[model samples]
Target: MKRLLLLGVLLAVSSTAHAIVIRHDVDDAKYRVPATEFPALVDMPGEGHGALIAPQWVLTAAHTLPMHGDLKQVVINGAARDVERVVVHPGYRTLPQTLIDQAMASGEAMLIVVFLASGDDVALIRLKAPVTDVAPVAIYSGTDEAGQIAKILGKGATGTGATGHSPSGPNRTELRRAFNTITSAYDRWLCYVFDEPPQALPLEGVLGNGDSGGPVLIERDGQWLLAGQGAWKVVQGNVLTARPGRYGQVTCNVRVNHYRDWIERIMAEPAQTTAVG
Candidate 1:
């Protein structure tokens, strides 16, 4: 089964945060790295969504895994490349229990059963070869707040906008997703329309399927930073019996600040990560 992810912090979320169309826990195994960065990430068969971060790294969604294993590839000219290693946020959990407790502690606890926050969805692919093409987007030292306007790019929902079965015998898809990813999900979930500006912020556009793992970037004082990772959408279905129709709502991106210590700790041991075989 595919894994899932999301974001909501503060030990517990406010009750109002629960009512939007939230993102479910679909595996972001489709995180595609560029050849210049590393070989194509495994599990992701085709042109998966990716963005350059540095000369030797590419960032992608954490769940983009392989049917058989977990080693993100680097792609170039439609050919698979090679890689040195990968560094994912240590906080990432295939089934994170702490995150679940946080979810349950809040009125939005169900968000945990389905997915975690978007804040930790990022995965960095370190390449044996350095990429000179696409430049890495800055990994912000800070995350954006509720009303900041940000841009997101990624492949969107598939199969006529409804779910379908993969035909690649569980290894790949006979019908690959057209990764024409676009705008980030707007404030429909995090904040209401009237909530925009002055102090409270809101999403500027719409978000949908295929946008998972996309970057939410915001420029503060003319400086760019990685604000959030697109996680899940809240769709009130049979599971949410109280609500009949899926409303406009979103999950969350876990705070980047929450994982700074973890990331720094891992990066401090670069040799160990590079030695992964």
Candidate 2:
């Protein structure tokens, strides 16, 4: 199948992708964080990522899973855990790649917007056994995400705002964390922009290739809460001029608060007779 390249809809690929695109002036090492700092962050089937929200439940993007197959395992805290079942949101839907490509090629902004709004791109994975070593992260229930500083963690493609996503692709072994302020908050999405040098944060950055389903966190009191999950990017120009993770680019993540009830409902139910792939 052809990869869904537009809207930053990352699919599983064999090549290693890079992570966070930082400011041109900032040292790349500053964004490198230890695994212990985010133990709940787990590796999904491919380059995608998910967070442990409950002992045996993982929250991730619905698009990250295969359209027709079983998800056998997910790596949590460096260990593989058996996946008992996968539950995709009832509202979730997959658009044809040809339609997405045609819209981008024609610069049909309206079509792009309609396609993005068509589904709730969220999912949950129930593990066969609970992970005792890692502490699960909490979901942010508040609606005031705008103006808040968010810490984005991923092991995807890396580059600078001046140059956009690297031609070198991803560095899978290096996990990085970067900060960005939420520019806007919608009912289903939390948006952030990649600011230029003088206005950017110390380690300011945005998502690149392979970051789908990764976590976007906001601190409340002293604890970090999961506010969003990396889903797609809204570029300002046509397909020819578009550069993923470049300056002024906006990333729209799946708002966790909006789907809190759905997550709760899925986790509350007993094991399903069949898993949704």
Candidate 3:
């Protein structure tokens, strides 16, 4: 099992803020989403979440996909399957050597590098066989997700801080979720800011480590559509003036509508895939 990197929290200031924040209780039955609706990617040893976007395809964050080349590394909801192919966005770039250098020089933790590499962070995993039992989620092709009610489901940790482990553990066996309204919708990203006062608490929740690659869903009529995938959490503290005001945390996702064509193209492409190792 590849040791999973902490998924959320990209800090802009030198001082450390609490890592990802998951508001629900670890075993809150109400927050748990059934495996049939959204299967947890047990690969990466339960590092992240993935949605069944098609009978044979799963959607996830590019950074969270297993790199060990062994298809056995990934087990979706206990059903083992080979990775037939993987399609990372053409524009996706993991931390470059240059960025690592900068991070090292600045005394930033490795996770900070992820915040620097945000944008086009989605990927599609082609499984060996079609998942006939699980229904695929529809991707939203509409204009934007701003101001829309969104639901995020994942098997990530539940708390804030260094040992902010979710009662669910790293490989959250049961998927949990929360509801929030989209605050900003850019051409390529959707975000939720967490600095609002308590009155706005009901309108939002935060993402935590291990929530990466999970789906952000929007309901259309009665069906839930995939609006985006959890990508990075941008944390900008008071870097200047030295007086740290209330910490600002932005939970961001790769907007699905902006890359609908690209997703279709990749899925249709010949299986010219590479091993994660």
Best candidate, lDDT-wise? Answer: 2
Candidate 3: where is the Cα deviation over 4 Å? 1-6, 9-30, 36-44, 68-73, 104-118, 160-173, 195-197, 201-203, 238-248, 270-277
Ordered list by TM-score, greatest first = 2, 3, 1
User: What would the TM-score be for candidate 1 when compared with the true structure?
Assistant: 0.54
Per-model lDDT: 0.38, 0.78, 0.58
**For model 3, what is the C-alpha lDDT against the true structure?**
0.58
Task: Predict model 1's lDDT versus the native.
Answer: 0.38
Candidate 1's error at 269, in angstroms?
A: 3.0
lDDT of 1 by residue, 1-277 (tens): 2322221111112111111111222223332223332222222333234445556655555655333654646564354546667776654555456655554354244545344433345466666777654445565564335545554433332221122211111212221211111223332123222111222222222223333444555666785555545454443332212221112333344344444455455545655445221
lDDT of 1 at 170: 22
User: Between 1 and 3, whose lDDT is larger?
Assistant: 3
Per residue, candidate 3 scores C-alpha lDDT tens digits across 149-263 of: 8877766655532233432244344456667778888777787765444534442455566667777888898888999877765444321121211225567777888877877
Taking all chains together, each candidate's TM-score versus the true structure is: 0.54, 0.91, 0.76
- TM-score of decoy 2: 0.91
Which residue pairs in model 3 clash with each other? 67-276, 67-277, 158-166
In model 3, state the lDDT of residue 9: 33
Compare the candidates by TM-score and give the number of the best one.
2
Per-residue lDDT over 1-277 for candidate 2, one digit per residue giving the tens place of the 0 to 100 score: 2123423432211111457778988888888888887999988766778899999999998767765678899999999999998898988877667765675567544555566666798899999999999999999989999999999998888788997774335435478999999999988888889999798887899877667788999999999999999887765656444556779878888899999988998899988757653
